[model samples]
Target: MGSATSSRSRASWLALLSAFTAGVGLGFLAHEYREVIVANPGIIGLTLLVVFAAGYLIRLAVRALRRAGSRVDTILAEELEKKPSPRPR
Candidate 1:
């Protein structure tokens, strides 16, 4: 149980770190492209909008996958619980 908890905590931390890293990378990329973005304000604005929308979609996908995994886990646990335990000799 303790190991499971620790592993979960580690996974949570790793996820957080990955999110932060991705955000930072995106920010850096945006900064690097600021000049080009500024030159074509209309296109830049559209691109930014697309990026935001893509991020939202990605977030939704991640959430859906997590929900699906959790549901599967719950169903498996329920099925396992319905099984009788083996008697000790």
Candidate 2:
């Protein structure tokens, strides 16, 4: 049990470190290409559009899933209520 917990903790730390390193590398690249990025207006607009579209799609999916979950909960509750209680011996 102790070993398993330690392994999970180590994995989590490694994953976080990897993500941080990647972010720093990306930051450097973005800084290096700042001039080129600024020169392309279309790229910025397209990026923003894609981001907004993705967010909208995710929102719709979450809403649909929540609705379905609520319906299931309601059905389950109704079925449980309809069940007759056992009589005392």
Candidate 3:
């Protein structure tokens, strides 16, 4: 249990680190290629929009899956309750 919790936190920490690295890399690119980025503002906007949309879609899919899993768990529990216990021979 402790390891599971620690791993979950570690995953979140890694995500944060990755996001930070990406932000720094993008900032560096924007600084270095300011002319190119400024010239194609539409491309950058579209890329950001796509990234946000994909993240939202993934979040929705995960939520739906979790709901379905819980429903299956409940259904299985109810079915189990309806069954009789076996007698010892």
Candidate 4:
């Protein structure tokens, strides 16, 4: 059960990374071929592409920050565990 939980979290991380990478790549392609995309798909397609790319990037950033917060929390917990509590004067 523990291993399964661990694997699930790892898989989610991998998926997030893949999504962020793909978003960046697609966004670059869209920018590069902006005129063609606009011509064929028009305003709607371009808007959707931009929104998805931005949203993915934002999600990646937020995930990274959350991970960092958890790490910091774990470190603090460990330190608290190691230290003795103060006594009344």
The TM-scores, one per candidate, come to 0.63, 0.60, 0.71, 0.49
Residues 2-79 of candidate 4 have per-residue lDDT tens digits of: 997999899999999998999899899989998888778767677889998998999899999989999999999999
- Between the candidate structures 2 and 3, which one is better when assessed by TM-score? 3
Best-fitting candidate, scored by lDDT? 3
lDDT of 2 by residue, 37-85 (tens): 8899898889879988997999899899979999999999999999888
lDDT of 2: 0.91
- For residue 81, give model 1's deviation from the true position in Å: 0.6
Q: Model 2: runs farther than 4 Å from truth?
A: 1-32, 87-89
Task: Give one clash count per candidate, in the order shown.
Answer: 0, 0, 0, 0
Q: How well does candidate 3 match the true structure in TM-score terms?
A: 0.71
lDDT of each: 0.92, 0.91, 0.94, 0.91
Candidate 1 Cα errors over 4 Å, as ranges: 1-35
lDDT of 1 at 24: 100
Off by over 4 Å in 4: 1-40
User: Best candidate, TM-score-wise?
Assistant: 3
